[model samples]
Target: MADPDGNVARAVKLETATISDALDRLGIVGQCYGIKGRDPDFRMAGRAFTMRCGPNSTPPGTVGDYIDDVPEGAVVVIDNHGRTDATIWGDILTEIAHRRRLAGTVIDGVSRDVHLCRTLGYPIFSLDHWMRTGKDRVQVEEMNCVVAIGGARVGPGDILVGDPDGVIVIPHEHEEAVLAAAEEIEAAEDSIRAAVRGGMRLDEARRQFKYHSLQTRKDAE
Candidate 1:
C-alpha cells in the first residue's frame, strides 16, 4: 500500500489522462464525465472531502456553510445530483477556499460567480456555471460520505485529480496500485513522444512503447 500522504503527493504530479489510463489498466472506474474546470488553466489534485446535497427542507439548511471545516489541501466535492437549475457554489465559497488553500472545489451541480474563481485563480470544476442560488433549492444532507460526481463514485479521502480535461476519482483502497499504474503509463507515453521527436515514425514509436496496450487491463493481458 502507498503511504496515504504520499499517494496524494504522487497523484498531484500526474495528469488525469494518464491516471485514467491507469484506472483502465487496473479495471477501475475513475474517469468522470461532463465535469470541467471553470478555467482551462486550472489544475488540482488532492484527497476528497465529499458532501451530498438534496432538496431543501423546512427552514432550508445552509448551503456551502461548512467550507471552514474542510481541511487545507483537500478537494471539496459536492454531489447535488447534477442539478443545473441552481448553484451550490459561489464567490464567497471561492474566496474562502482560496484563502484556506484548498486543493480545489468540484461540484456535480452548477456554480455561480465563476468570475471570482477565475480572478483568484482558484480551481472550481462543475457541470456548468449558473447564477441561480441553491439556498432554498438544495441543502447539504451529508458530509465526508460516498458521493457520485460525473458518473464516478467519490468517497471521503478518495484521490481526486482535476485539470482542464476534467476529474478522475481513485478509491482510497486502490490508491497505490492506481498511482503506480499511472506513473508507468505516463512514462511510456513520454517515451513514445520523445521517440517521435527524435526521428522515429509515430506508429513505430507507439509500437516500441506498446502504447496501444498500455491501458489494457491486467487480467485481459
Candidate 2:
C-alpha cells in the first residue's frame, strides 16, 4: 500500500482483513471469495476498471482487446463467472500491464502464464491458472460496466484493495466512510497488540479495546 510519497498513510498499510472488517461495520457485502494473489506478498490499491465476459456469441468470438484502454493505477476486474477451464489473461497482457504500471488485475476466471506474472512482479488475483486460452471460448461483453468477482459486484471506479488475504471491492459511493471505518479498525487492533506486548493478557487487551465491536454495525451500536 506504500504510495510513492512516503506519507505513511493508512492506504499504504490497511490489509484486506481490516478493510473487510470495515465493510462489515458498514453492513456491506464486498469481499471477493476464491480469488487469490499470485504472489502472497503482493498488495495493491486502486480504482477498478471493470469488464464483463460471456460465452462467445459467435463460434469464434475474440477475446477482449481493452487492455490498451486501461489507465494507469486502475485495477482490471473481469467477470468470467469463476471459470477455470478458460483463461482471460496471459503473459502478453501481464507484460503490458507491468510496463504500464497498472495496480493489478482480478479475474473471476483462471489465467495463463502465471510464471510470467511472478517473474515480472505483476500482481494478479484469480480463481486459478491454466493453459487454456479464452480467445474463442469467451469474449468481452462490455467494459466500464458492472461485473462480478466471486459473486461480488464491481463497477468501474470502485475502490479495490487486495493483498495476500484476498480482494475487497469498496463501492465508490462508500469509499470515504469505508476508509474511515477501516482506519479505525486498524487502530483498535494496533492498540490491542500494543497492550498485549506490554504484558496485558490477550483477553484483557481485547476487552480494553472493545475488540469485539470493531466490526459491529453502526446501526447496532
Candidate 3:
C-alpha cells in the first residue's frame, strides 16, 4: 500500500482493482447516478476537486479556465444541479483534460462531445449526452467546494473511485482507515472463495471465517 500522502499526491494512480477490493471488503456502494434508465460506464480512479456551476456560469472560456487548474491525473467532479439546457463538458475541454493526464470526469448534469471523449478513451459520467454547447446557460461558481452527488456529500481531496459499479467518494479523513479495512476484507473474501472452490459450502466458509463479524471487529479495533 502507498503512504497516505503519496496516495494523495498520485491520486489517479490508485486503480479500480484496489477500489473494488476495498468496496468488496467494505460492502458499500460507490457509484452515483444522474442518467435515467441506464447506468453510466466509467472505470477510472481519481481524487476529486468538485465544481459547482449554474446556467450562464459555465461559458467556454470559463470552463476551459477552470480545467487548467486541475492537477494532472485528478478527476474533475462537477455538480451542475441537473441543468440540461447547457452541457458542462465537451470536445475541446476533453482534449485539454487528456493532455493534462486527467483520469476522467463525472458530472451531475449533461455533457457534450461524447464521441470525442470515447475516442480519447477518457471516461465521462454525466446526467445525459447532448450536442448543445454550454454557451450562455452555465457558469462556474466554485472549485474544490463540497457538492452533492446522488445524495452523498463530496469534498475536495476525497478519493473518487469509479468502475462498472459506479462512483464512490471516500472522505479525505477516512481514506487510510477505509483502505486498510478494505484490504482486510479482501483477504478474508479470498479465503472464503478458495474454500468454496475446494467444496466448502458458501455459508460454511463464511461462518468459519466470521466474515459477517467484520464490522464489529472493525469498530472495536
For lDDT, candidate 2 versus 3, the one ahead is 2
Location of the lowest summed lDDT over 10 successive residues in candidate 3: 31-40
Q: TM-score: which is higher, 2 or 3?
A: 2
Q: Is candidate 1 or candidate 3 better by lDDT?
A: 1
**Model 1 lowest lDDT segment of ten:** 1-10
Task: Identify the leading candidate in terms of lDDT.
Answer: 1
lDDT tens digits by residue: candidate 3, 152-187:
668877787666545667777767766676556667
| Model 2, residue 79: C-alpha shift (Å) | 0.4
Task: State each model's CA lDDT, in order.
Answer: 0.91, 0.86, 0.70
Off by over 4 Å in 2: 1-10
TM-score attained by model 1: 0.96
lDDT of 2 at 35: 92
Candidates 1 and 2 compared: the better one by lDDT is 1
Which of candidates 1 and 2 reaches a greater TM-score? 1
Error of 3 at 206 (Å): 1.4
TM-score for each candidate, following the candidate numbering = 0.96, 0.93, 0.79
Candidate 3 Cα misplacement greater than 4 A, ranges: 1-4, 8-41, 57-61, 214-221
